[model samples]
Target: MALSTHVPDLAALELLLGVAQEGSLNSAARAAGVSQQAVSARIRAMEAQTGVTLVHRSPRGSRLTAEGVMIAEWAARLLEAAAEVDAGIAALRADRRARLRVSASLTIAEQLLPGWLASFRAAGRVGDAAPEIVLTAINTATVITHVTEGTADIGFTEGPQRPAGLHGRVVGHDRLAVVVAPDHPWAGRRPRNPWPVREGTILQGARAA
Candidate 1:
């Protein structure tokens, strides 16, 4: 079945995640125990729905466009929460109050979560916790808002600052990259020096200036 990109509709998100991790549609299909055709179809469907060219395909393999990379990062978090839910449930089976509140970025919310929840549900092992798992998805800005407001118990985001009035744990790390097209004259040297010297740019994201 073809996947949709407008919102990834669960199955499509899974496919995007597989492709991101595997780096090749064929490998993703193999790992997923599906056919290459299926993977291709999924990608096509997503691209159509989202109206974005998400993948750059070449002989080497496939790489994500900016949006694709963003989506993949988000999906990883959703995947993590799903894992926690499963572990919590497994622990609960042995112990019933195993609930947690997870706050994530919009990208993670849309691309790769339902499957994790679905898998946990399929396990059929109930958690001992209260069984109320709340999920909230917001941007880097709103995550801080949720944290500051004490509305969220946990947060996942790319923001480097530790906002006041909340405790944060580094559940994941992501690095921004500088990309220069292959046709550019600096492609060779660019690899050697990923970060170019700054001229007038000021760094505002870091804490304490």
Candidate 2:
């Protein structure tokens, strides 16, 4: 028989993650602000859709099956990505009374921007509430283009090179280090010389010789 194509809803996914963390249906339901019966029904419905026995229920409590653990992990990742998408959409809304427009690379958007924005709000730079911030995540080249064209008030990018026609300041720096297992041959080697080359060249060399 062909597998069902039904995808679990975000709420159900969240419930599964809660169950995994809380380790019991009653506790998961309480944390979710729902009744235990509701949690049970939702889990049953999810199992029916996926055609998998996800949870093992007994008089003691409820526990996830082996498949349930794997599915729950994936569900957690999906929910996290969904949250980022929601935040990006809120930032991109044109109707907001925005005080700042920022264009950033994916690394900055995913890793740094949220915390910085939270700090800015906490500092009360604008007021008790956060100033409206419109943000876009794009490539480094696109970030430069946006800043140069005045489409964004500020831009964040990686790499040392800066495009002309824009005043740049280094807010932070990151260094790439080669990581190897302790047992690997290169783990004990100390480089006598270091040289800079295009990233593509390094990747090609890794693949070739």
Candidate 3:
């Protein structure tokens, strides 16, 4: 896929996010361990690429424009996702003498894997050298497939039904609730005859909505 010319590079995006946090280019540069001039150059380059004046420079300091603030917010999210990808790659490349490869559903990988890994590390089960943890996030079917094929040591998924050839155990459960807009018909209705909500129905309704 072709990237837009307006999109700033990852390094420039990071600098923009830092400026948003520090509220000044010089301060942001200092915090990031980069020269002030380098920060300014990056910011200027980003502005040129984006075709927008991102910063308002003054004698006192620098401040982001309204658009700049919005862009910075988006940049922060992008940087966070990038960091996750970096960590996954590092884990794959780490010393593999003793490693635990895990395949997980997207929800579990995003919301639970970090905490679980941290707790496992704290328990010191792997002796002096910490066991390398490599994780990949995919759909539930793919998670099951990876485990069944012996490519992954373990798998985590959110689906209630387990596939064949796998011994399943429920570590936990998540409670789901129906949500609707205040004006929607279902907003205040407590159905006398409750029906099981299937994934296909919900997906169809969502597409229609």
- Model 3 / residue 185 / CA error / Å: 99
The C-alpha lDDT values of all candidates are 0.66, 0.78, 0.79
The sequence of per-residue lDDT tens digits that candidate 3 reaches over residues 1-209 is 99988899898899899999998998899999999999999999988899999999889888999989999999999999999999987776554436877888887788777898898887766667568789898888788777777777778877557666676667665655678999998889886765553121000011110
Pairs in steric clash, model 3: none
User: Which structure is stronger by lDDT: 1 or 2?
Assistant: 2
**What lDDT tens digits, residue by residue, belong to model 2 across residues 101-191?**
7888888789888998889777765546667788898888888877777677778887767666666766775545688999999898987
Model 1: which ten-residue window has the lowest total lDDT? 200-209
Write model 1 residue lDDT over 111-205, tens digit each, in one string: 54465556655665454323456888777677666655556655556555665545555544444566789998867663654443312110122
TM-score of predicted structure 1:
0.38
Which window of ten consecutive residues has the lowest lDDT sum in model 2?
A: 200-209
Clashing pairs in 2: none
Q: After superposing candidate 1 on the true structure, give the runs of residues whose Cα lies further than 4 Å from its correct spot.
A: 1-5, 58-61, 90-209
Task: Give candidates' CA RMSD values in order.
Answer: 28.4, 21.8, 21.3
Comparing 1 with 2 on TM-score, the higher-scoring candidate is 2
Model 2 residue 201 CA deviation in Å: 60
